[model samples]
Target: MSDRTFTLDDLRRILLESAGAEEGVDLYADISDTGFEELGYESLALLEAGGRIEREFGVSLDDVNLSDITTPRALVEAVNELLSVDTAAA
Candidate 1:
């Protein structure tokens, strides 16, 4: 696992790329207020994004409840919470 920390921009890029959005799509804009469904994303896209997040942040989110993560803020919060735990464990 890496020791790198992720920022909102990283998460946004990962998600947008995973979701197959066009280049330069800003997931952190007003779009963050919308759900994935509203953004035309499906479960598989989120799963891929989650995988990228794990690889990038060096944290496991396999046990996280994705159903509650409807927006970028929620995703960031979840990742931060997991990162805090990882930091504590280290």
Candidate 2:
């Protein structure tokens, strides 16, 4: 992978693939956008998914900051932010 930009659809695809959801499952909307306690995803889904994104993109996330990750867009932004730091350092 070339560390290309990620979208909500991309994160949703990863979530669907990891969570074993079918094509009809609206993970990004129904899951990621849901409140952390309400969806039970903040515990690991977003964090692990974030780690995967970082690994796939050759970057690293500030994993400790996942407490506020309530949406795929947030995840994307976090990954992008981390990647930006990585770019700056490189």
Candidate 3:
């Protein structure tokens, strides 16, 4: 497992890098509860972001249903949970 704790900043960076933020979207704002669709991120974009997260963080997201993770906060929580599990295992 990676020694990195996934944060909102990390998610923002990955989302922007992977799929580019929407034109009018303020990714820096408090978007924890904002839905991805509201933020102009489609399912495809989120999939790409998930892939990037898996690669960058050395965690597997195979068990996570991206569709269920509608908000950035949920995604961050999920990734952190995986990271915590990895930490426990280590």
Candidate 4:
């Protein structure tokens, strides 16, 4: 398994950097269960954030179904799962 783990904080930062935090949206708060749409992030913003995550984490997200990952927690879990697979393959 990979030593690296994708946390909420990391996702928050990347989402902020990729598309910026929405006004009145407290990204610092516990948003793991919050949907991206509820957080004011559109599909484009999410795609951008996913791109950033892929590049930074050195993992391919093409196999994962983005439509199913509607929350920060889901995204983080997907990324970490991919990281674990990568480590196992290596």
Candidate 5:
């Protein structure tokens, strides 16, 4: 696993960059509470974001339901949980 530990800001930046770039949308604000669809993030955008996040964070989010991670905060929480599990395994 990666030794990197992500902060909320890091997660926010990653999500915004991934979704905005993938979806061609200007999600240039703090969207911690905003839903993905509301921010113009479709499945392709979200999946791309998830892939980037998984690769960057060194965690598998394959089992997580896409619908459950509608916002940046939710993604942060899920990533933290996965990181915690990795830590425990290590």
Candidate 6:
């Protein structure tokens, strides 16, 4: 896999443009880390977060399990595939 880099800002843009969301709603708000955990962000919050992720990564979250995303990194990897991330691999 080729080393790729993308900023959180890129994600924010996609979230707003594609998912029609604002940064005001943050799932990783109080969490120290972004990962899937019952103790962490709730499913709804996770879904919302996933929406931003899918938008940012240009991926589809329809069939993907909610639990599949436990962290930002995992989310990126999974989404990269759907997005056809050439800068990075999923």
lDDT of 5 by residue, 1-90 (tens): 545666667865766777544355555566678777777778888788788888888889889997777887787788888988898889
Q: Could you tell me every candidate's TM-score relative to the true structure?
A: 0.80, 0.65, 0.96, 0.94, 0.76, 0.47
Top-down lDDT ranking: 3, 4, 1, 5, 2, 6
RMSD of 1: 2.8
Please report, in order, the local distance difference test score of every candidate based on alpha carbons.
Answer: 0.76, 0.63, 0.96, 0.91, 0.75, 0.54
Which 10 residues in a row give candidate 2 its minimum summed lDDT? 17-26
- The C-alpha local distance difference test score for the whole of candidate 2 amounts to 0.63
Q: If both were scored by lDDT, which would come out higher, candidate 1 or candidate 6?
A: 1
Error of 6 at 62 (Å): 0.8
lDDT string, candidate 3, 1-89, tens digits: 55679999999999999999899899999999999999999999999999999999999999999999999999999999999999888
Instruction: Identify the leading candidate in terms of TM-score.
Output: 3
In candidate 2, list every pair of residues with a backbone clash: none
Model 6, range 1-90, lDDT digits (tens) per residue?
334344445544443454453334564353324444523345676677677765544556887786766665565556656555544553
TM-score of 1: 0.80
TM-score, structure 2 vs. true: 0.65
Runs in model 6 deviating more than 4 A are 1-40, 55-58, 85-90
Cα lDDT of model 4 by residue, 1-90, tens digit = 466888899999999999998899999998999999999998889889999998888888899988788999999999999998888888
Cα lDDT tens digits for candidate 2, 1-90: 234676767776666555544444445565545554454454566666766776677776655477766656567777777766666776
Candidate 3 clashes between residue pairs 3 or more apart in a chain or in different chains: none
What C-alpha lDDT does candidate 6 achieve relative to the native structure? 0.54
Candidate 1 stretches with Cα past 4 Å from truth are: 1-5, 22-28
Better of 3 and 5 by TM-score: 3
TM-score of 4: 0.94
Pick the lDDT winner: 3
